[model samples]
Target chain A: MVLMFKIFKNGWLDIFAALKGYELAGVLGWQDIRQRYRRSSLGPFWLTISMGVLIGALGLVFGNLFASPMKEFLPFLTIGLILWTLITTAVNEGCTGFTAAEAMIKQISLPLFTHILRVLWRNLIIFAHNLVVFPLILLVFGVPLPATALLAIVGLVLLILNLSWMMLLLGVFCTRYRDVPQIITNLLQVCFYLTPIIWMPNLLPKRASILLLHANPFFHLIEIVRAPLLGTLPSALSWQVGIVLAIAGWVFTIIFYGRFRSRIAYWL
Target chain B: MTNILINNLCVEFPIYNSTTGRSLKNHLMQAVTGGLMGSNEQGHVVVKALHNICLDLKEGDRLGVLGHNGAGKSTLLRVISGVYAPIGGSIVVNGKVTSLIGLSLGMDSEATGIENIYLRGALLGFNRSWLSSKVKEIVDFAGIGDFIEMPLRTYSTGMQMRLAFSIATMQQPEILVMDEWLTVGDADFQEKAQQRLQEIISKTSILVIATHSPELVERVCNKMIRLERGALIAA
Candidate 1:
């Protein structure tokens, strides 16, 4: 019991110390984006442009195929894809958060949590860039701003909280097992189709939709934000699921992270 | 009052082979079979990097760690720097610690020299305001005229080292840890760097350095210990 207490204390302290280094994480995060597109004339707008093209192309093809009207379908698809990208990129990058900083990890003693924050921050920046397409989509599709849109901020905060834990857990695991990254990438690919990013969840009959969509944790995660941004309040189920997942995920992650946080440098 | 108290510290590395050792499949199979298949598959190898080491360093102590390659010198320094948590025993450190082990680890080649000052400085735990205050001094000490405005990749190796060395020594640490004496830049800069390094070492309350050079230990450190195959052999 004493050992467990010590682990929890150290884990919490690691996070608290890392929080003091947020400026370092933020700068490194911006550098990742800037370095990736250094020579390009358009710079990070390239992220905006590519995501815009994908949303435009997919919106037209999928909207016609599903026979959903363009007015509602485009905004739904836009928000869904944007949030999905944020989730997947954060997870994928998290797998390398420790391993990628092998030099810094071995040589210096920065808090391990700082690397996880860097991954999340980088993906968040990318998510912000991709979000630039949303306002443009709203303009083109003539979607009205709704008061429910403010709720998306709460959803976003919850989503970030959930992603942070996932990143910490995956970062520790992936550092130890080299093959875990490939497994994660493949699993996320499968999840992309399983989740309703491109398709409308309402397509299914009422009973089936409720069972399938409500059961999917990813659907709720995306819905909490996407639903609010699309001018409708998310169902209480979505908010409940989001809150429950955040708490449960953090609880599990803190224990796991605390248990193995010290061993991360050795694994790398 | 700055000190480092380590008691019977042990550090071990689990050396994982590519195929079976570090794979999720192997771990799952182990869970399923228990010890049935343990003999055939080569189990993970564990290398003892540091074994039952105890040391106490107080203020104004300059301790040199002398070891041959693979003798755990780097590992010991890492443990002292708080990078590697000892698998056994405890270490109580009562001072702010700074490591000069990898001076250029976080630097960005795509970033200009001035930007890298902030980048590397922040990685070393210096805040933006402090870094901003020292930017001009670091730039001047580095003496890479006008290169500060250009991307670091454009600078030659010596210029890069100069900038890295300057930024790394900007702060006075309570406990300073180093892997070796740094020899940076051309002869002129090397002389200047040596002087700056000596100044920092003198000001730091406790110094831990690992080096192969006995001459460096004799010239600088007040105490010295030698290690062989992860065990302390002499003091």
Candidate 2:
């Protein structure tokens, strides 16, 4: 249909245009990170310090609760928390992509996706800061840095790609209906429990419950990165699930974006 | 060449129910429970912001738009700037447009004045290298030497206006769109701003200004139109 074709064209244009504006988005993203800690002496290291405390506390409590050894549990918990923060923060912030930039969106005709990329890029910077804690945890636990660990880059890239589409989709959706942001937040909160960020899927007694992990797009998303970082191959299923979600989400987003892209200005 | 072509353009804004205006819950409930019977089951009141209108503009055209409050002056400017898309008809614009509709159009009050220049400039689509070369010129024109280091909120309203005006007019745009006459700064700075604004306007190929001052229109515009309640009227 003409609508579908229009959406396809608009989607590609938006993406490439956003990429073309990477310098602007990159600077904006850095400004956000800098502004958040402007008055502080430690600056972004505060992120690392707070994350260190969080992972430490969670590692101790959960390690005892799960009765897993310190060596086994700490790295698992550390990687899980870091990846979760990267992902959940990206999703939650994506909802505000347009709404938060109401002044810019309403005043100028900048590509809408630039805001989305800014959010992702800002979160990635924070993720990079949090990643500093990972090597220390790995050293403390003496986890081997096998050759497979490099594969995490592929997973990280896929996760970023997937989140970009989600940003495009959710940014437009939430702008029109303000309550959508809160709804998304609540859903992500509930999903946090369901997706095994703090808990392991293997602990589920019934084999049928493993289907929960298998079906969860979030699990596959986290697993693709977490498994590789833990010195193991991510299940082929995670890659398959991640790629499928990326394709399907982009298809839906393109159509939805094409139909609603113009409405965004009105919505704001 | 700078140009804008619009045909039968109409823009309508949907006013959602007061309670459901921004609520996803009400919208989703209406969608799922109301079935697929009608799209307007949520009961939105639509406001026609701009009626069917046609206009053609090209290089060397200085079109002045005249309207009172709620008379679609800002809306028309926004439509031309591509901030708002029309609900009907079509528009084709060929130029790099700079919208100086608001004094602080893309500024962050919490950000320092120096940082805001880069932020606003980037929002206007200027690349880093160009901005780097223009920074000293813009700062000098703003005339707030030490204040530029402080947050914009700390600056006086006039100082803020000077900074915003300086940034907006730093580059010669192909299509310059403005909502009102930007007369800011003290008497001394005002004279300086006037000369700078005149220089920039001369460089612009197509200029669209929305204002209430007939003297301004007579002085600057070659063509003019009036609007009443979102409909064009005889000028």
Candidate 3:
């Protein structure tokens, strides 16, 4: 189709630029980290320790009430918590990606798409550090690492790709509306309980649980990625939903970026 | 040869007066949101910064701008540099441009003086290797001594001004734009800063400076124009 070809052609530069921009963003991120930890004794290790304390506390209390054994519960809880932290913090922090950098954006002529890439790249580096807690927990539980680990990494790549576009859309909308991110944050907090992160999907009433898993992209997002990390393959339907979400995310993000591309210079 | 064509450019800024036209609903929204969307009825005034203006400059043209504040001097520079778009005309600028509009636009105060040097360099469109090569040269020019290792925020007003001036002039570009005075630092440093400005202006093909400093304007500019309101007067 002519329309499909036009869409592909338009997005080609964005994909190429995103990769290049991410590399520069990584250097900027390293510069930021060194600046933050340069004088401090603890350095970047404090990030993992903080995550351990918060997740451990929540896991202990919730595991008891939810009737799942401590050994089984902690790993599930930790993985879900870590991923959600990444998703939420990325969306929340990215709201001001341009506004916060008014000084730099106004001064130089940088590709505005680079800002979206920068926020995603920084959050990903944080997520990389937080992953250390997961393997350490798995080792403590006497669980053997499986070949499924490779599959989970593939899932992680997909999840990151998906989240990158989601943040791009959310970041632009949030900048324009101001109230949108606050409302989205509040709703995500509520969705934390309704989604099967701390609790098992099996425990839910069949219809409601199935609906949540199929209808809510976040549910499929968590399962496809988290299930493999748990050394168990999940429902094939999650994969089905994931592929569709990927397509939708890319299309939506392209439209979002295209519409607001020029106005970004003025908003800052 | 670098040539810049600016045709029929116009810019306006909206001023929102909350004190004069504050409504109860606007106040309530402000209290909850901490920032306003600043739409109609809560007061808006338009100030046209640049009127319909046309100009053409080829290589070896050093144009000086003289105007009072809010008289569209900086606004003209911004429009030429592509930072602000003209509500009306089109601009055709051929060849690379390095703008030094604010002098020290992106310097992070928390960063060390050396780090700020590299950061500032990248911001002005310098690559890693070019900046690295110029590191010592820039530091020596700044003359801030060992304070280059300390946070830039700790630098005195004169020291910060030296760093900003040193970094902008270090890079040689086809077109150099100076907004306001190049006499930034103290009397001693100002002499060195002005010399650097002269050096860059000589090397560049087109030099457009927007400033109200009468002495500096007279000394450097071959062609000078004064602006009243948004219209250019006879040179």
Candidate 4:
């Protein structure tokens, strides 16, 4: 109830700030994205080319190593790699959000939360670009593009909503702890193996697969999201777990963000 | 009363000691041989930039600031700008405050001088058409020849200050905060800058200038505050 009122009071200011941040992020995204490929002949096509090669290499090597077919495996790995980049970029940048904005924070009286939101919004723009490669890879691999393709748009919305609060919570906590990002990085590296992104879920036995589906939020976020993009939406039960985790992530992040949002400047 | 209430403020600056690298071999060597002693000492003791400070300013107050080297003038400007958060005490501010202490530093180095004026203006909460309509006035006041279209990095310091001063003064905020460095420049801009400042002084509700110069303090300020060792001294 207290949080509700606080948001209500500061709602207009926060929204205006976020809008300003989004505009700035779009400009910054253009620069960052362009600079990375400025001298390269292919420019943004490099993203598509590099991702295609990465998916191909991983599918060939890892697929052969694990005795999986290269055809179906390519689509799975391509979607997984794209999603992985988004998660990694958001988490890593979110961790250092305060430090990067230290100059702006010190110079202006604007809210510190603006910096975190700006960084996340920029990463989201990049994610949008990388997502272009996902469908192309799926199409090239002879997958049927279905009417459920609209689910990808919904998933993107959920991803942003869920990640926004996660960013606030993690951004604040990381500033205070300083070691939190490192710990999270280490944990995320391990999660990659157990989450079954590169590997299909059916490969696991019934019990283990269901357990992984329920317990691992990343898997569910990706699985539910990639399900439509990969031509396979999750069952309603799977959707339950994904939707619940997404809501829970927002709740947890918001609570932490609310507690420390006012104190972040001092921490930095 | 339109006043600013400031309690204790302490800002610490940390300079990392790179004498000892972070490699494990350095750790092992330090365990046995202690790579460098100064690195360890500098590592722990932070420079107490501002100790405990308390003050209040009323409406129509033109307060002159004085301090020495390593004095917290810039830090104080930063704190009031909402850049540096005070470690202790509470600050109550009334009305809109415009800070021009590091005006040029915030200008985008890659952008044209004219474009940077708008960028900096937007950062200060001005809208598009507002800056658009005011662009020519800002450019005329800056007094830069033809270089307004060039990147800021290409301009001379005096040229940069011309643009900076123009942008900084664009908003005649209720409270205007400035650093003493505003007085340092070529004579041409100085004479014009002084006239502009005088015009602003009479109109502004509150003006706080940090300077070691008694002339700057006495001529422009009706009130004075001296700081020593992070505490206020009687004027």
Reference interface contacts recovered per candidate:
0.92, 0.70, 0.30, 0.32
Best by TM-score: 1
Query: Which predicted model would earn the best DockQ?
Result: 1
lDDT of each residue in B63-177, candidate 3, tens digit only: 8898776567776776667666565677888877778777777677888888888777766667778888998999899898889999988999889989987887887789777
Model 4 residue B92 distance off true place after TM-score fit, in angstroms: 1.2
Query: How well is each residue in A1-268 modelled by candidate 4, as lDDT tens digits?
Result: 9866565445335435666655444444454455466557877777677777777788888898778876678778877888887887787888888877767676677756666666776777677677777777667767777677779777767766666666666788887788899998888888888888788776888889766766877776776677787667766765776567678876566555555565566556
Q: Which one wins by TM-score: 2 or 3? A: 2
Candidate 3's residue-wise lDDT over A215-258, tens digit each?
77788888888899888896788787777788888887776576
Query: Of 2 and 4, which scores higher on DockQ?
Result: 2
Q: lDDT (CA) for every model shown?
A: 0.88, 0.83, 0.74, 0.71
Candidate 3 lDDT at A19 equals 67
Query: How would the candidate models be sorted by lDDT, starting from the highest?
Result: 1, 2, 3, 4
The residue ranges of model 4 lying beyond 4 angstroms of the native Cα positions read: A1-45, A66-71, A142-144, B7-53, B84-88, B106-108, B111-115, B136-140, B143-152, B181-192
- For B56-119, candidate 1 gives per-residue lDDT tens digits of 9999999999988878888888888888998888898999999887788888898999999989
TM-score of 4: 0.81
- Tally clashes: model 4: 2
Q: Any residue pairs clashing in model 1, and if so which? A: none
Per-model B-chain TM-score: 0.88, 0.85, 0.81, 0.78
* Candidate 4 lDDT by residue in tens digits, B1-235: 5678788766654333323444632454333221122222435323456656777888899888787654567677777766665656777788788887667655666668877776677667776678889889888887886889997789888788788888777777888888874663588778888788778877888888898899978788988877664556554
* Model 1 lDDT per residue over A120-140, tens place: 999998899999999999998
